[model samples]
Target: MDVRSDTALRLPASDVSPWVGLIGLATLLSYILFARSFPEISAALGFENDLGRLSGPYSALLAMVLTGGAMAAWSVCVEKVHRNPSTGIDWDRRRPVADVLNDSITKLAGLWATWFIIAGLYCLGRWYWDGAYLFAMQVMGAAVVPLVLLSVPYVIWIDRVMDDPRDQSWHFGAMLIGRENFDVELVKKHWRAWIIKGFFSAFMISILPSGFAAVVDSDVTEIVRDPVRLGVLLFELLFVIDVQIGTVGYLLTFRPLDAHIRSGNPFLAGWLAALVCYPPLAWGVLGNILQYEVNTADWAYWLADYPALLWLWAGWLVFLTAIYAWATVAFGIRFSNLTYRGVLTNGPYRFTRHPAYVAKNLFWWGSVLPFLVTNGSMVDMIRNTAFLALVSGIYYWRARTEEAHLLLEDEKYREYWDWMQENGAITSRIARLLDRMNPRKGMSGAVQPAE
Candidate 1:
């Protein structure tokens, strides 16, 4: 027999496909039925019954069941479309829906898992400590809701604005969940870079004594009662916002650059380096650790004293704003060359090449100063100074490394550097001071001198 006749002879008939369809339908129905009654089951198990009266737990359960059924049906429809080879589902046509659905499900699963873990932890803590669990829950709930409300929308907005619709395949959601042609080497390189950056950033912000109280011990109630401590807590919260925003921006912009430098041992070297460096850098080596015990009304008390901290916060905000603006402009310029897309770059970057990093360092110093000045502890002073030195050194080395990379890639960058040098626009003083202070040579030999 010919090949076509042989293949047709071996093929299963359409009647056999009904079994697959039946199985999908059963799965959908079961999910719907269970989901519809979930609320009542939850209430019976002592979960809060806040889903309303008439449309209560049962309605929610029904909705869940229906959604699952709908998803299964959608999948079946896709399979049916794919069954016919000649006029079947095309990659371009099928991909977007699959990607979106896959991304949504993955995100939902992650969110649910996180919530479940947190709730479990809360229950465990409550059991261990009398009255402490209830207090912790309330405090955590209060802090969490507001922060989520404020930050989530802002994050979504940032993502939307920064997103290039043409490059949707490059998105984190797509890369992780969709069947895109991903570069394994590129993913590994950028993953390492992000982990390094994120670890350092997290340590700097969270290694404070207050962080330990709020996170590990779960003593939020005690921290809220003291005015000074409350002030520090609020500062920490804002600092978190600044760091997260900057880190996200940096990752998006430099992902391609990191991806270009992939190696077989990417994770091994980077992970080891981060683990070795972060502990001493965050805890022992750095100065001025802010400590707090959890207290009820801590957030309320902190808000009340906002007027006093307003000026300092204002300065900090200004510095952070400048940094973000600089990043936006500079990265915009660099990205423009790739796609010939233009963005406004007339402000901060016009003055300094790496103003964002400089401004961020300044912001850190501003945050550290209030505590050192007010508390006036020698240990705190020394710690803060050490932190400043370490951060500045790191920033200096990074800038030099980045500039050298640019020098190799772009001839125009050399002109820009030369112009800044001739115009005395770049400040090399900080880099010089760092070099003098360190006995060992940095990764990059000389500071490219700030331009």
Candidate 2:
């Protein structure tokens, strides 16, 4: 097959069917409904429950389980993802347990060592013990024993049927034990994937409880009358959806669902771009050094006098936030910052390559109104706008590094890249604008994204 042919290259069918995301979304919505009505139901049943709302952090954790389990079941039963070639499993070719027993033992050794290193890093990072991360640390501490005990059986069983059981974990083990020749690159890939999972998983889990609780306990009586209040409530709800769905993506990287991390971004630039946008580093750099919202009055402040404009602007911001959440939902159980589970060509992706980034940056600009300062200092206004532009530029750089990683990782991503250049609605227009500016980009033969 000529993969580069126009007929073959045009928008390939989505690797992840949209139905996977829908099932998860449906499960999440139902959970939210039940959480909101729990108090009323408890009272009707003459129960003595006194919490008044299902706002516990554990309830939020349960939301992740429900959403993740539903999506995994759908992937295994409906999509038959377990049968996919990428899983590296051949159910019909099971080997004698004794044949792969040594390999499984070595692999388990590497897996245990990797977990220990990750746990050490978690303890070393001070942020993990502070603020929202405390819950995450508690959860990890509780899972330590269970994860260790379950790894033995799971590793042994999977190794017996795997087409070739010497995977990345095996290579790492071989490197450590000096039992046989091990590829240097495979060991690096193994560590890279685990490091990404460790770092982002903590951040994602740390954020889940607060947003989940907010959505469940939101008081909408007063919000129903005020446009600003209603808008903020909606923002909280949408962000909870995004965080819940995205957290599931991080937690459920199981082979049966074909959602394992194929690779993590290898470039240092990718790491810097992503890390600086999150906590600790972001707290110092973007929040303090380049603080763009120093004297800014947000959308509510500016539009307070104009009631009609206030309502319209609030609605506009809500729309952008919805797009941000929708982008995460489109990933189904495959969403993560620096990994590729599959090529997504449906939903908001069919229009723009980076809908989440674009919407997120726009949301910041609209909500903060950074250019319109309260003190009316021209220097402050210019500084605010310029810093915000720099923030957006960072997202652009992140997008580039991601495209470069995926371009080299899979041909499907390359095909999607080419297809978007020709047929994507927003992507095609952006590509044209860039071409008009460079006029030499086509001759380069390098795949660059409009993101």
Candidate 3:
């Protein structure tokens, strides 16, 4: 099993099996038709409806339907592009919209079936452990376990079935040290001359006031009295500190001996849109364009009309920031954009493919509530919606470009990309949309291979 052998390196033959699409379609149809029976199904399983007004009987059903549709769309896209190894006419050929839509519907059925089994298992768990704490734990486990079971086996199957018989040694652990060639001269040169240095300088200057304000506004005595408050404060501090460390590390530390830099997206729209996200640049460009700053209002003010949800809003804020910092910690010193330090499959990375981007975007949407801030004017509503959409779209572009870069850098990344497509529990709507936009394209906005 010589992994480097040319004969073994090529992709395997396509599995254009009709049964796959048929099974998926059947599963999707079942869910959509039986959605009304979800409440009865839950009750029969001994699971109580505790979400109350926040989530009605139809809520779970609707969520499941939407999830099924998204999963189906993603599955079909991956199959159309990556699953078929035959790279000639079929590679460039575009299937008719009707055929694509049918395939997607079929995948939705497969996804729905998977969720159905998971829900049944969740019900079984509830029957066993009826306590609130245990029920909550079981609910979380149920959400994740099915996906892991389905996806992990798929990854292993792909590896075993691949023509190359991918070397186990090429996994994430091997990526940590890389090809050990520690060039001291190169490290010094990079530190002395890099655009990242200017970014670090600007970042520090920008974060200063917010960092200071976190400390200044907190009441030490009050924090000490309440454990929950103390925990929240500590999370905020850790978030701030981790972000700074990540910024510094991006420029000053964690040098890879053997590095591969991917070509940047040439599109002005992608880079320019992404640039306005950071400070100094944001202050210069976005500050002028935006009439009101999003962060000026509290989460509760924008989210819930009642003051009762303040604590809930605060909790969400803490959760969001913690996840962001968790991602930074996972990356260690390899957190730069448009570059591959190495493949990271541990920590938060293990949970989802792009936890940082997803979490950051989630936080922004939750905190900003752009549509909620109408301010008694149609124009304001439109403006806020447009602004947030632009910001979100930029991040989406960032994710796409980064994926393109990684896909070109190494075969290992291609393997990872495939695994994520099959098994990753979370899906990015933006990523899916981009793929839909050009299903036949290898990587949108052409990129140069790593030198």
Best of the candidates, TM-score: 2
What tens digits encode model 2's per-residue C-alpha lDDT throughout 261-345? 8888899999999989988799987998779998898999999999999999999999999999999999999999988788999
lDDT of 3 by residue, 302-375 (tens): 54464456556667767877777677655533345544555665566545667887788787777666665534
Off by over 4 Å in 2: 1-4, 439-451
The models' CA-based lDDT, in order, is: 0.39, 0.88, 0.47
Task: Look at candidate 3 and tell me the lDDT of residue 109.
Answer: 39
The C-alpha stretches of model 1 lying farther than 4 A from their native spots are: 1-313, 320-347, 370-387, 424-451
**Per-residue CA lDDT of candidate 1, range 287-322, in tens?**
224221111122233334685565445545555754
For the record, the alpha-carbon RMSD of candidate 3 to the native fold, in angstroms, is: 21.3
Would you estimate the TM-scores of all the predictions? 0.34, 0.95, 0.47
Instruction: Enumerate clash totals for all models, in the order shown.
Output: 19, 0, 5
The pairs that clash in candidate 3 are 24-106, 24-110, 25-106, 27-109, 28-109
Off by over 4 Å in 3: 1-193, 205-213, 223-235, 254-273, 290-296, 302-308, 428-451
User: Who is ahead in lDDT, 1 or 2?
Assistant: 2
Q: Which ten residues in a row have the lowest lDDT in candidate 2?
A: 439-448
- lDDT, residue 178, model 2: 90
lDDT measured at residue 52 in model 2 versus the true structure, 0 to 100? 72
Superposed Cα deviation of residue 302, candidate 2 (Å): 0.6
* Model 1, TM vs. native: 0.34
